[model samples]
Target chain A: MADVKDVDWDAVMADSRFQSLRRKKTIFLWVLMVFSMTYYFVLPLGAAYFPHVFQIKIWGVLNVGLLFALSQFVVAWAVAFCYERRASGQFDVLAKEIVVAFHQQEPRR
Target chain B: MRASRAWSSVILCVISVLVALMPNVALADATVIGGEWRALTLTVFAAVIGLTIYVTYRSASHVKSAADFYAASGSISGLQNGWAIAGDYLSAASFLGIAGLIALNGYDGFMYSVGFLVAYVTVLLVIAEPCRNIGQYTLADILAYRNDPKLSRIFGALSVITVSTFYLTAQMVGGGVLVKTLIGIDYEVSVIAVGVLMLGYVIFGGMVATTWVQIIKATLLVIASIVLVMLVWVPYGFSLPDFMADVVGDPKVQARVAALLGDSSTVMTPSELGQRFLEPGLLYKMPVDQISLAMALVFGTAGLPHILMRFFTVHDAQQARKSVLWAMAIIGGFYVLTLILGFGAAHLVGPAAISAVDAGGNMAAPLLAQYLGGGRDSFWGNFMLAFVSAVAFATIVAVVAGLVLAAASAMAHDLYVGVLRAGRQVSSGQQVAAARVATLIVGAMAILIGIAAKGQNVAVLVGLAFAVAASANFPCILLTLYWRRANTAGMVAGMVVGTLVAVGLTLVSPNLTYPLQKIAAANKVLDAEQAKRTAIEAVLQNPWPQSESLIVKARAEQVALDKAIRLAQADIKKYEGQSRSFMGLKEPLISLKNPGVISIPAGFLAAILASLWIRDERARAKWSELYVRQNTGMGISKSVSH
Candidate 1:
């Protein structure tokens, strides 16, 4: 029981039920990474790069920094919602398949 | 009765609107309990749990095997582990620092919250499953999977010591600060108290008690913070703008708070001109420091030695992953609440909330509670303040206990038994005893350090630890998982170099400078006012019944001295003679150089270099033995440790 180790990558990819789930997980991961990396760039560059903060005034008052910050909250919320939705259905199905496959593996020769 | 209740609220809303529309000095002075409540809450909570953990670990420890000590026999539920992660990860700096920062700087504080959340994705996608797949007991287990026991043990021991020490110092400092604030004990006493208690807890009960205590603290803190947030947001009903408006309307409150925060104001006053030196600009100023600070949060959170160790407590990789997600959820909510709590304090209490009279208020949230809640002179109000303060202390203790355990475990289990003399098994009882002794040593060290750095930024201490972990530990672990040619030599170099560079840079970095406070202030004098004259003036005023004219002259002199001192502090001329700054390179590109202040990014470039130094091993055969053994125990990972 203690000897279990390694993944059957071939079987996981070939399995029809798991394929979409795997793809979704990959996409989700990348999306999350992009958002974060983008976040790093945003904080450093927002004041310099964005003209909205300097030039464009919304309602004759609030400028670009405030707008950009406000948008960040919305974007974060959106990403979280996306994660919860995908994780509930797509990720869950994938996890089950992976776990099931593991449990069913043949003993070592 | 219903109408009367409705009328009361309506009248209050009208009053609130009026207050927001004009500058009200009376409202600003409206009895701020100062920031004492956070300190108070911190003291109680830390005392209870710190003491409990220490006593339990020292006296009742029965850890016979490494499995018992490190994994708790893999008996903990994912949820329990999940909560413990929150308790452990949300160290004192997180609770007090993030909240206080936001109160002073607006949305920048929220940025810290997001940076923390983002790192989980990195962990979830890249590290978590692989870490679970690789080794048991510690990170060394994974890094040295293919190497000799001797090799693994060395790396493992090193990993344990470095990660545990870095994490523990942050925890101890945080605990000490909270204790000093809440209970009015000196910082030294607070540090010693925390260290002793944490050592005892780990020594007695090991993982079982640590897990339970952390989970309890996490839940309680989250609940309490959420309560405070809701009160601030919906004191009568939920209107976010109304709350902000109230904060904006009081100029005296704004001036006082703006002064206390130094250069954080969006709007500048002539009075605020002095603090402008500290106000970080968007990108170029402390750019490297800022980026490093953010990176420290993002990557450091993922690779913390103790945090990864807790993952082993769960049954499978899936459970570990689930626990991480759950922790993120709880912690995310808490961060949001912290924003509200901080703003509430700054708005309701102002800067006066923080004082020597009620030392705990430096913790921010308490200062906020007093502002939003009631009169400190009143019994019910004071009790509420005391309760919150106690809880904050407990939070610190919970965190310290976990860190102390991690460090102690390294010394006893990894260094002494595993590496020092390999193949000679130590009995569980012996292991527990060794761990207990180690705990005491670590606790003592933490107390000494914590006392030395009293009232320092809890956030910065935690950040430095994170920077070290991310630089040294993360690089090594990642390379081991993905890179096959990652010889033990390369791994060792990467880990050691990474740890040293990150730690060294952090110590010498520009962000270490606190606002407006500097070395020049310590050594120099402005105008003709000397220390002798100031002291004499004070003595003269006290001893004699001074004439009105004499009083006027003395007061004017005092005011002039204050102004001159402020002017001297504002402009510090630095002569950089052949100065190559900290990150081992000369020019820093990303720190706060202008307004809308952000940190510099020199640390990021350094970390990237540090990470790149670890080459990915390409040999597949390195994982062959493990490849065949994969499909068996609890079905976790088929991946190879590089």
Candidate 2:
């Protein structure tokens, strides 16, 4: 096991790179979660309570509920795509620095 | 290891030889495939089986260690593992069942697709990377990483076994249903066949075979869906709007919609049918049931044993995250295609035809394929039908193999190694052998359950499995990762309570209880008729009550007859359009079809409260270490070393 005492965990946790990565990831995840949850739950909740709204035809043979459900696929893919971009482009850089520092200290231990 | 490898090769050779020799006998029973494409389907199925066996044979040689058996030595690339994850996730339930649901029920079925896809957000953001970092072979590794290893492993293994068994049964039952419908085999035989094949894959080839099989099946499924969508699109001038317009105008579709709306007398217009089809309330009439279903699906995917196990197959946490994204992309695309195939079946094949084939509309996709290719007796039609059936078969095999592997790992890695051995040094060969034995046992159990559960609603079984998974496993895993004070007691309490509530609620809920009540009512009526006849015969033969007493007795008999008729009439009325409720009750006690919304929170609460009652400082202290390891993917080497 990697030595817990070899590198100061508290110092690592307080590192600026780690903190920023956590903040950005947490914010993005929360935003996507809220958005997707609202978008998803609205159909079932609306179907139960205000099903009439879903009957409102937005286009020929298309209504609010079907359109909304279809849009969710788009929304999910978007969330995944955006998360991947940020994780690889931004978060990985910070994570790699921490790993490198740990590795550099590992030989001494 | 050498002995096992040789044994696996022998098994593969026997299977291959049997497959080669058995096709002729299977083809002679041409009535099984409706006599049109029997030979073609048998050939294709044999070829598919042969290909999987070859893959298994190749993979068997690489099973020199437990790590190789469980996670393929972490050699699968992010992209390949991503496809495998999608393959593992999209069981027969999603591939054929969802499309069938959409074709029959319309807009409400699409809700399942949305919930399933949106679930990846939870997996990717919260579970995937951390789970990959902390765990080696099974999910138990992660849960046991910080707490009392034995207790945590036991609870984790129990939950894994429970979830996987439920899921495996569902997949096995689905396979039986599909084969029975497609190839006209006995349900029991079909179930046994699927069981044997899945057992062979896991026992001999392990994760290596399972992953490749999944990738192959996923690719075929996606391609088949896309081709079906295109076939559907061509009929409407390649325009979705045009297709909807055509569907709205089609007389057959309008009639089907009117019938579904329970207003055939009114003769719904084309526009009205279109509006109803696009709107909700077709299948999921109750909002609460819909909400609960959504909850179960969204959370359930995160807790599925086979799916969680896939994260370990990737090289690192980053690869795991990437794989989740790739799975989302593939799954999202497939769901979108389902929209087309579903609507196409409704428009082209018509609901009456779909219902005629299978009341639950599970045959809609295959029937659509047949229709698109040509008529049922035509070569194109038969070939398309065979291809679709082959794909569905592959889908079932892939999913069941994954489930068996997960269950086996739980038994071998968590139960035997972590608990029984008490962290003792066991050879990798011994561990691999144990996993194979566990796979065989699990596979046998699944087959027996599948045979027993023949003709039961496969969709409800799958839903209940998801509800159990969401309730029992999701809460415990989530809390274990995020909640520092979570102890062994908390984990055990949460899982046990969650499993009990989810299962208990489902058993007493309207889904099962209502149908059972109907059967009882039917039997009661028959018994009452027999008793009434016997009473008349007794009165005629003996006439026990004489004179005034006889008069009173006759009156009493008359009253009894009148009451019986009235009760029967009431039962008939009550069960005319809906299932009979318990004791002729007007409404069920618990109305939600899925118990996730209630059980999930209950589980989390149980875990938290239990932890509050019994705090563990050492576990709490380890949280920082786990957190750091989870975030940066550090210290995973130590955990993976075992």
Find the candidate with the highest DockQ and give its number.
2
Lowest lDDT block of 10, candidate 1 chain A: A54-63
**DockQ of every candidate structure:** 0.26, 0.63
Tens-digit per-residue lDDT, B222-282, candidate 1: 8778777877787637654456545544443344434344324424542232222112342
Residue A27 in candidate 1 has what lDDT? Answer: 73
RMSD of each: 12.2, 10.0
For every model shown, what is its TM-score relative to the native structure? 0.73, 0.87
Worst 10 residues of 2 chain B by lDDT: B548-557
Output the TM-score of candidate 2.
0.87
Per-residue error (Å), model 1, residue B287: 3.7
- What is the per-residue lDDT of model 2 for residues B1-642, given as tens digits with 9 covering 90 to 100? 564566456556645644454444454333224654667777777667767777887787787789989998888889999899999988888888788888877887776678889888889878999899888999888878777788888988998998888788778887887787787765776787788777877877889999999998899889888888988897667776778777666655555555466423234445576557777888886777888998998888898889999999888988898899889989888988988888788888987677666767788889899888886888888788888888898889899999999998999989998899985888889988888888988989999999888866556667877887888788888888877688777887888888989887876677764644664675576567666656545665674653443333334344445555656666566556765553455446787788888988888888888878987776787777777778888766554455
* RMSD (CA, angstroms), candidate 2: 10.0
Error of 1 at B247 (Å): 2.3
